[model samples]
Target: MHPETHLALHHTRATDLRAEAAAHRLAAQARRPYAIRTRLGWTLVEVGLRLASPRPAFAH
Candidate 1:
C-alpha cells in the first residue's frame, strides 16, 4: 500500500476508535448517579447496623 493511503486509513481508524471510547465514557457518566446512590444506600445500611449493635462496657 502507498504511504499516503496507509496514513489516511490509520487516521480514520483512530477517529472511529476515539468516537467509540467517547460513547462508552458518556454511557458510564449517565450511570454515575445510580452508582453513587447504590454506594450511599450501602453506607446508610452500615451506619444503621452500627447504631443497632451493642457496645461492651469497660471495667472500672
Candidate 2:
C-alpha cells in the first residue's frame, strides 16, 4: 500500500514538472517575435536621438 501511494505521488510530480516546462516553452515562443520588434524600436529611438543631438565642433 505504501509503495503504491509513493508511485502515485511520483507520477503527479512528474506531470506537474512537464506542464511547467511546456508553459515556459510556450511563453518563450510568444516572446521571440516581440523581442525582435522591441529591439528594432529601441534602435530607431536611439538613432533618432543621435540625429537630433548637435555635433561638437573640431578645432584646426
Q: Which pairs clash inside model 2? A: none
lDDT of each: 0.97, 0.97
Show model 1 residue runs off by greater than 4 Å.
52-54
Candidate 2 lDDT, tens digit per residue, 2-45? 99999999999999999999999999998898898999999999
Of candidate 2, the 10-residue stretch with the lowest lDDT total is 27-36
State the displacement of the C-alpha of residue 57, model 1, in Å, after optimal TM-score superposition. Answer: 2.7
User: For each candidate, C-alpha RMSD in Å?
Assistant: 1.8, 2.4
lDDT of 1 by residue, 3-51 (tens): 9999999999999999999999999998898998999999999999999
> What local lDDT score does residue 5 receive in model 1, on the 0 to 100 scale?
100
Residue 17 miss distance in model 2 (angstroms)? 2.1
